[model samples]
Target: MKKQNSLFARKPAKSPKSKASMDYPETLEIIGLSHEARGIAKHNGKTIFVTGALTGETVRYEISKKHRRFDEAECVEVITPSPNRVEPFCQYYGQCGGCDLQHLEHSEQIKAKESLVLDQLQRLGKFNPESTTPPLSGSDQEYRRSCRIGINQLMRDGTPIIGFRRRGSSKLLQVDNCPILINPINKILGKLKAVLSEADSCKEITHAELSMGDQQGAMTLRIKKPLPESLSSSLQKLAEDNEFRLYFDNGQQINAFGDEADLSYQLEKSETQIGFKPGDFIQVNASVNTQMINRAMDWLDLKDNDRVLDLFSGVGNFSLPLATKAGSVIGVEGVEDMVQRAQNNAKQAGLNNCEFYRADLSKDLKALPWYKQGFSKILIDPPRTGALEVIKQLEQHQCDQILYVSCNPSALARDGAELIRQGYKASKFCVMDMFPHTSHVESLVLFEK
Candidate 1:
């Protein structure tokens, strides 16, 4: 026979079986969105979840995962695009997991989120609000003040990818810049990448985090070990050059180096500034967060004589504001550090009316000192899992009004069901686009006893 190439190239082998199966694309009509923002389609009685496909659009999709009752797909072609669809601004739109609804119109995205909240409340909570207020929304882009980015130590052409994980995969995609971040953050990415690349300790970095306060920004390098002298000096110079607070977390403790110590975000409505460390949890979208907090306060209709209780309160974001209007505000948080920070913030603001106590809200509250306090109104801003145990004891407190802020609709619905059972009726509901291009739904509901 004629000379054959190496064994690997001996034959132009057939495509892998899984690849071949996915190569056969199917046309699908998207009708709804899954909880993860994937488009939902029905094909031959099997439900297909499609990424990059908008509702009311027909698209050609390739199967990525096939299960017994459902299949997962990635949209290949938009055969019929929805009117609400628009070209994505980011070049890495479909690939980056940071944003999912960038292709959909911003207005439509908020509407869809509002619809999702209402639908979940109806289905899971078996309750509906008496009225749905207009959604609180702001700029569709460049609104995030807090962000986290992953760093891939694996070298590609002697350079690592610094950005976010790819959609449905652990692989990292290198992004020059992210549009959702504020202008200051975007301005530093190029310089930040260069600094990381040149640093000898770059390979040890697991991720980078940034949070912008009103005057300054903080960046943290989560590393596997302490950086060498040379790398630390380089990072310090980079922070000084870019006017950012930089830190290195070597698993045990974090060491800061830069002029970022006075970092605080001011709540204009209440005129209170909340200080936080590099890794503390805070709201991402400043505008939406302020508006939402103001809305909650308005809904509570605080009076000088009304005592307010804030549950799951973080650094007095809502409690400090509530203290300005209510007789006294008692904030309960699960994290002791956060509770201490909230107390300090209240003290700094010269607001002696607000007090914070640490309590594991996810656990039983029967023995907690604040558990017995009867407040005229209450506010709860729970995490994704919601506050089931806290809601269960609401009947014992007998608060007249309660405003619940939730980032997950399903969790809110489950908690809402319990609230209704405890003799509370949903009154006003509001949704906000806290995360512009993502399916994250931030909703607030007011319940009256």
Candidate 2:
């Protein structure tokens, strides 16, 4: 037998098990919760993530996915439940992928999200806020103003199945009602499903987006191809009966069925009504959106002489409000259509001081015409990717204040560190419960130079 070299020697190999055998049910002691709201546990010295398991609870779980470093599990039975665990009110809570933290109590859900933000800041950015404000939250249920309902035809029967996706799967979960949606949207779900099930061309639809504004509602159906005249008329009749605007989108352009007023939401504090088309991006939670805008305004401490720059501005959500208080406001957006919409919104709001510009924010913005004007304060509401590029250019602007609105905590933490490196100090940080019972963390950070 050849002598083994200790330097390159392999340890005694353990018996290999098949995938099915490796997934045998195992008991674990939940130790913590991940940023995604899954419970953390240890099995054979490896980390296991258990869904539907609360921290500090003993649970029986089965591995759903095995990875090299960690394993993902689905909680099969709760040996002991945490005090913070609560009964999810929605009938389709476990099945629907729309919500992740419904099993966790509402208040505890907020706490977990708050903790997630702070943890990400420390772990990724290696920085902490000077101070944190109390979390801003609204009603836990019936708070969602907009939602996209997935549509698919049942394999067994040709009937339409409507609702969100099943958890961790591409399959559709038939949900006639969702508790998180506002009453109006929930009330129409069953009726809409019934109508679609009866229509011969319902299979042409991929999904339907429902949006509710303060005064009106709109529904947009995404179709693979044009619907027949009969199907179009039936959908229009349904929209009329439901008192909502109806539109069909066939990959290229959106076409309205009947003449209905545009959808608009009220920002009572600023006395502004923002009108948007059905496909336009709007906050899903209306109340939380209002509160978030109010908080942003207060945190920025706008002054009559201040010139505000709102980056990633969408439909003048913050620009119009800032314009109402600042000397002059310049809104820059990447999408030309959104810039036009923002301009129209400003014009309709009768705010002559507000101007909207179209620019690619990811690239160096120094050459932009609006950059030469300079701003005393800047508000950034970039998408989930965060505003690292914008944060890098802030030192050149020499703005006194920078208010960042983030929907993704990891991205926020990364950019927050960049701001600190530029000599700005994080003054106030607060988590917003814009999406309750979900792992999504929305937050505001005020950085003062």
Candidate 3:
């Protein structure tokens, strides 16, 4: 039998003095990066995860929190920096929790995400793809079409603090502009902040959801109470001046200020328009989303007689596009409003072959009427929790092809393993840079029988 190394041997419990000394700064070489983009190091047989550090660099980190299996730390100083490190452009790069890989070069960031996805598949799924295509990426800045801005009414001397949350804290970090947001939204941030500062009902405001479509922009403010007429007029004027639609939600119904403007994005390849409400989920990266959909269509090799089943379809984002090529397309979503919205979108697109249904995908779906159909191709864009339950149920359909778009790699790996067990082989795999500068991983995998 192989003897265990003393370096990894279990050590006796440390005294109170030794435990206190652990708070001191320690220097170590960063050997790897965690899924969250933190540096990985080992000290005295215990693993250490250091934030703000990169691989192949020597860093001095201070322990922030200690755990039984490992220690958490924050890099205070870099003794040696890697060549891939770049100066972050955003002024609030380190202070804001919106981005994680701003300091790393953009190309290196893509490679890291791809590596992370592959690592998850191998380590968690216990499988490897036959081939990995080049990663799908777009502009790393000013690409976010939507954002949720936090509001702290109690902060900054009664003036509403508007921005994202601070790094590792619930406290709000006031930001004048975020580079990742689209140019129009960034341009109006200061103006909006000024308007809120002067408004009497600003304290009643909680947060704001901003979304930009191909032709128009929309903002929805979540409020605790009804806004006064004066504040409402000011907001309406602001939206008019900015050429964006404004709406107010008081935890019940959403009311528009002036005319109800249609908020929708265009899928250029398919020539399809998808309309969505303010709080509805849509891909923030427009370029990547277009590319992702186009690639999915190409990978599926849609035929005129193909019957496609789109799971977790949102506002017919994919179902409408698929209907343009396939003979028939069925969309299943968990939200009733989204199902209705999708049906309306399909009707507006003049695609009668596409249908939308509301179903709880996590529960047993065998009893659903749509389950009886023999689908030739299946596409699932599940949430971060993934589609393990749906994948398990798919075995009864004998689908010829399955395309999965995932935002969470761990969940994808768990579901991918199930698909593999059901006699599906992963043929094509690629990472999508959906959220640039962040540790979030979005990927696409095509499985074939």
Candidate 4:
């Protein structure tokens, strides 16, 4: 047999199942942010990933590794805030790890975010005319109508765990009230913390999904240990105490959790009700979502008979609202649960004109059945990866108007280039500050085909 290569020998035959837990560098400074999710700090001309840090705040972190270009570090402290800092509302502000920009002024956060978006558009689209650029700023706080939290086991103790991932990895972060989540969810943080603190069997938790339903909020705990027989009682107490349903994961939990929990959201400027589940992906800032949808619709200039397509549609956020104006609105999503929720929400809102389909839009989207139709307006809301293939599909449909909502600038730029390749001009770009105190930016771009 041939000898194994040194590189192959050093590497595992198979990828490690578990992610590496890392400590941020013990010492670091708040340098800046690319958008908002990541923090930038350089040490001795090296870079570090400082988990749990804000710009201008001197902090301590543990170094994860050293690369030829930069080092990765996770946050451990928040020494000081920049002059533009503000107090955080959520009790779980730091520990929850859901909202990092809570410490900065929400308005200032928008200005910074707008700068980032404009910078990216110029860099990628290479546009400079003011006619194609519009000043974009809108609601900057209390925008999260939907959010997700990881549910996992506690440490050595039996503590039940629920909340966002740690600063840098899958490790669960201990959290209380989330600053950016709905008041209904944030209100239950303390009770949740206390409950999990008492669960001795909680040791190897993974993820928790928090969702806002049509009338209330729901919490799903993904625990590593077997749920106790008193799971209902514990959850009942928690719900009574916090006014939100408690859901347990594992093979036995499907009904017990769903039957007890229901989440809801009030549509902006309307009485439309949206129901969501723990696993459903909703916008973190409900308020901003409304503005975003409004802006996208405005940019698309939907006519009464226009057909609109919303890719990566979650909970019918844009699709539901857009349906109110357009002749027909179609939403495409990857998660079936979210698709169902969107459909249910449409039914509840009495919105028959809106439809949702579930399919993976990340890869080749040509196989999707609903994708056969051409659209007058296309709204793409993709994750950090942005909508590359989806953009291609839109090109295939010969869409004339495109509104792109992006959270990642680099990916947005890449996809923007693809749109340019397809003869779409970046007509207007603006930024929405969904996150404050952190270097994150939410951007909206309108392109003409």
Residue pairs with backbone atoms closer than 3 Å in model 1 (clashes): none
Per-residue error at 228 for model 1, in Å? 1.1
Residue pairs clashing in model 3 are: none
lDDT of each: 0.82, 0.84, 0.86, 0.67
Per-residue CA lDDT of model 4 for 135-242, tens digit only, reads 444444444655666556634655666567754356777666555556766666546666656655544445555566556666666665656756556755776566
Candidate 1 regions exceeding 4 Å error are 1-25, 258-260
TM-score of model 3 vs. true structure? 0.94
List the candidates ranked by TM-score, beginning with the highest: 3, 2, 1, 4
Query: Which candidate number would show the highest TM-score if scored against the true structure?
Result: 3
**lDDT digits (tens) for residues 1-449 of candidate 1:** 22111111111123234534554435778999877788999866788888778898887656666779887777767778788877778887777878888888999998888988899999988999999999999998899987888887665555766888876668888888888999877766666678777755477778888778888777788988777888777877766565577888877777786455567999865568988878778998899988998898889888999989899988888888889889999999888888889999999999999888888887888887777768899898999898988888777887899899999999999999998998899999999899998988899999998
Candidate 1's displacement at residue 299, Å, is: 0.5
Off by over 4 Å in 3: 1-20, 23-25
lDDT of 4 at 233: 67
Comparison by TM-score, 1 against 2, better one: 2
Candidate 1, position 274, lDDT:
88
The numbered model that scores best in lDDT is 3
